[model samples]
Target: MFPERLKFPRRPRVRRRLGLGFVLGLWFGFLFYRPVAGLRPLREMGRAWGDERLFVRKDDDGVSSLSEWNVTGTYKGAWGFLDTTNNSSRFPDFKKSNGNSVIELVSTPTKIKGVHYVQGVIIFHDVFDNERTVGGAQIRVEGVYIWPFRQLRMVASSGKGGEFSQEDDYILSNPYHLLGVFSSQVFQESPRDKIWRRKNSPVLYDVEKHCNIEFAAQISRVSSNQNDGERDNYHLEGLMESPSVEEDGDCFSPLLLNATSLNIEVYYNKAVNYTLMVTFVSFLQVLLLIRQMEHSNTQSGAAKVSIIMIGQQAIMDAYLCLLHLTAGILVESLFNAFATASFFKFVVFSIFEMRYLLAIWKASRPMNNGEGWETMRRELSVLYSRFYGILLGGILLMYEFHNYIRPILLLLYSFWIPQIITNVVRDSRKPLHPHYILGITVTRLAVPLYVFGCPSNFMRIEPDKNWCICLGIFIGLQASILLLQHYLGSRWFIPRQILPEKYSYYRRLDQNSNHATDCVICMTAIDLTQRPSDCMVTPCDHFFHSGCLQRWMDIKMECPTCRRPLPPA
Candidate 1:
């Protein structure tokens, strides 16, 4: 027989104080985390690297060819120049048996505004005579010049045996003012500042004063002893173009010649696919969360806030996932732009995880305590605003540092792994509901994958065949886990019920008892005179409507009021 009225003990003050302190500590730790090293120097270094220019030359003497170029730029393996030149010299004299002088000029113009310019490898064929005497003739390269309001008209013809003939392409228009040539390898402050103010000339002839040129024999040669036969016997040259232009007149930009664009296409594709998959999982989790919230008897304000936060994150994730997928089909610049934006999404998601943990903490505590809901909500709002501001500031800092963001994110994710595992284990010990298990497992797996399988970092330097294979395996594993969770959740993880006689003791309500007139589960009055048989009492002496008590028992065999475990049936 249970007591007609039961009194529950109050939570100790020390425990509440400890919980608050722990939450504050977590918040402070995340807020104060900063990169150990300074970032300004790294940014300056990148800008300097981007300003370096590439110079290339080919002559009739075949000794120094296109196979001698060396690249020295910030975007190392991500971009380069391609040499498509056949081994034949483009020099006019080389075409005739009697002549020895040969020369060719190739240029690729890219959209340049200010300091930012499109970067790619320029591909061209080089031909030179093997004889030192013929190679001695210098093959000069005139510095890149901007043509204001003038377009060059050029014609090309295929020679016998598919060879490109040595023909000069000239502008059809009369004398047009040449903005200037980038004369020396090193220029004063800006390349535009080097524009020569001399009289306008139909053809540029001051090769020594206005162009950076190299003799065919002097170009760096690739040693035949260093590589296997399959190695691409091509020279590498670094090129950096400036966007500065003279605002004095209108200018028709020169067309880029034989420019082969180099970008991380495979990397972007992988990133899009990964984002889609993660978004799908997040959507599924949101649905599960909503369903749980609907069926849950714990209707605390904190619980509602948690559900809302998760829903917001799911929406944001879906939007960003779509943005990433769209970027894959767009231009290279757009692709790169979204790549940076995607990192912000990851940071936001990390912050959401912290909010989620706080929500869980609030939900686990007794909501009936005298704490003000309005005050808690206000505090949460303030914290969220601060976190967002921090994230925005961090993005600016990361953009400046460029190379440090990835490592910091990696470290943060590594730290989260243990926390996720702890949460999963703790949740698993409770009632085994399908949604609960699925949610926990997906979250546990997703965090680590997000940390390690991020496309930007994973595909950074162009992975080899083995790395691609490993990536395939990782994708397969993620898919398999998802399918397994779905199957088990739908077919085998139904909630179990506790037998009434085993965990609960029945007691009839009497008019004389204080709590006998009230149902604690619904917080409604129980009319003992009208329907006394509808009252049910648990082992902890808590009274609830019979139907309500049965439903609660099906979910968990514990006293609803005191949260005490019931005796075994």
Candidate 2:
């Protein structure tokens, strides 16, 4: 019903692109956000409350402590089995009730004598395991935070709660939580206290809860950090000091209670930064491909690239793509961060690169058979099967021997092996571009370095300096060899005695031989006795002027006379 001139075109592609860009920009903006703006109201409320409560305080330390103790907001944590099988086995619902809880510290810590405590309030809600809460229970939390100790000694009692909120109650599995959950930190002597242990310098805490049963917990501060995260990062460790012996209920078994650092912002930032790095590097690789494509690369240098190495890289990029895609679907922010990077990665990295790599490989391979077309297709299929079979086998190996991931990675990065071997075997002349070698080596190393070297990477894999150094040296050595081959000939390292006889194009015609023939390329030669430099001889017994043959090979890498393959000068 709309007028033809006024009707707008529905360009779904453009719309989608714009929408994606907007979402990515929004997430990128969030990456730089230090503190959440939503908490400003709560912080201000705490300040106002502090102003009124300050008049009642006598000690400066008490006043200062109260000001920092604005623990009135929401707290997220869960109960899980703490791997200490001997103790954790006691919890009946340990596996099924491995769920999370959101506790709102709805009021300030009311002081009694010399300690602060939060007791007898609607503190926690919507606690779930594999299923919902069995029956309502009142959770009472009372803690004495001693500044001298930098410790939290909290005891909790339970009865019944009125309501619960199911918002963001994720069906969670421990991702990074299990990394060092069982590990202990080293003791360091601080100037403030002579006895320095993890017990003294603690952060946000831990707790234990049951749907209908009464449980008690001894809470200790695991860790606390400032400026690095939005909240105080903690390793909340809970120990049940008491239990309701009278109640017949499925109570917390092992009593391995924990409070943890929920650093969503830090996670978002890390993912975004890594995504950006990959996007930029992938783009540079595409550019290198473009430059290479511009030149007439007819005689394939597929031999110069390692197929196994390419397969390893292809699998790496494929994993990254899968990772980004899954994370994007789960997190709104990650969708924006991953989209552009994933698109560019396809151009130079993952499955897209495999097709290009294969095309070059197939073109370079000899078609010696009479029934060439069928033979080539079968060979290609066989190559594909072999490549994927190795990849599958490698995956299984990784699964079976998970502890040796570092060694597997080191082996995978040795992608340049094929090129080095090919150059030595075939004695190909400058098969790989110097820029391509350098650019790829550096870019490929970035992902591994970020995963294992960077402390704040979302993966949170511990930095291994020795591994990083070894990887750098390893890749650097490969690039150096390739560059040396480009300048000093492919078999430069081989001894003179071991080298094969190089074919001679500059063969001289002696007095006994009248080897005079016309230059097939220019159709004018017959100069047999001028000089060896004046004429060139093909392996097929054809002759041509040196300059004429040189120029002809540049256009077509085959014999002008016999139509046979010509070796690069």
In candidate 2, the residue pairs with backbone N, CA or C atoms under 3 Å apart (3 or more residues apart, or in different chains) clash, namely 90-253, 91-253, 91-254, 137-160, 138-159, 138-160
> What ranges in model 2 sit over 4 Å off?
1-262, 293-296, 300-309, 329-332, 350-352, 366-377, 511-518, 523-534, 547-557, 565-569
Model 2 lDDT tens row, 1-569: 57754455556667999999999999877853423353344235434423323223343223343233333333446654444343323343233434444333322333322234443222222232332211112244544433222233444534223232221122111222211111111111133322221243221012233232222232222243343665644333443333435354333443444554455566668778888998988877777655544332554445444555556667777656655665565555567777767676655664456865675665556464356688878987897788678767876887455446788888888888877887888777676778878888998899889877887677524478899999999999999999999899989899989887888888655434565667767777567867778888878777888999876765556798779987765
lDDT of 1 by residue, 1-569 (tens): 24433323334566789999999999877544422122233234434433212112333235533122222111112121132232112222221121212123334443331111111111122222332111122222332221210111212211212322221121101001000001111111222222321132211223223322211111122345643343323222233221213332211111112211122343345455555555555555555545544444342323323333343343344344444534433434335545554544554355444545455445645443467889778766876676566556654664454334344433332322332233223322122234644464455356334534443432222123443345445444533443443344211222445212223345554336553356777888875444655777666666677788766654555778898865422
Each model's number of backbone clashes?
19, 6
Residue 119, model 1: lDDT of: 16
Worst 10 residues of 1 by lDDT: 172-181
Clashes of 1: 19
Candidate 1 versus the native: TM-score?
Answer: 0.33
Best by TM-score: 2
Cα lDDT of all candidates, in order?
Answer: 0.36, 0.55
The deviation in Å at residue 257 for candidate 1 is 19
Candidate 1 stretches with Cα past 4 Å from truth are 1-362, 368-374, 382-428, 431-460, 464-569
Model 2, residue 83: distance off in Å is 24
TM-score to true structure, per model: 0.33, 0.58
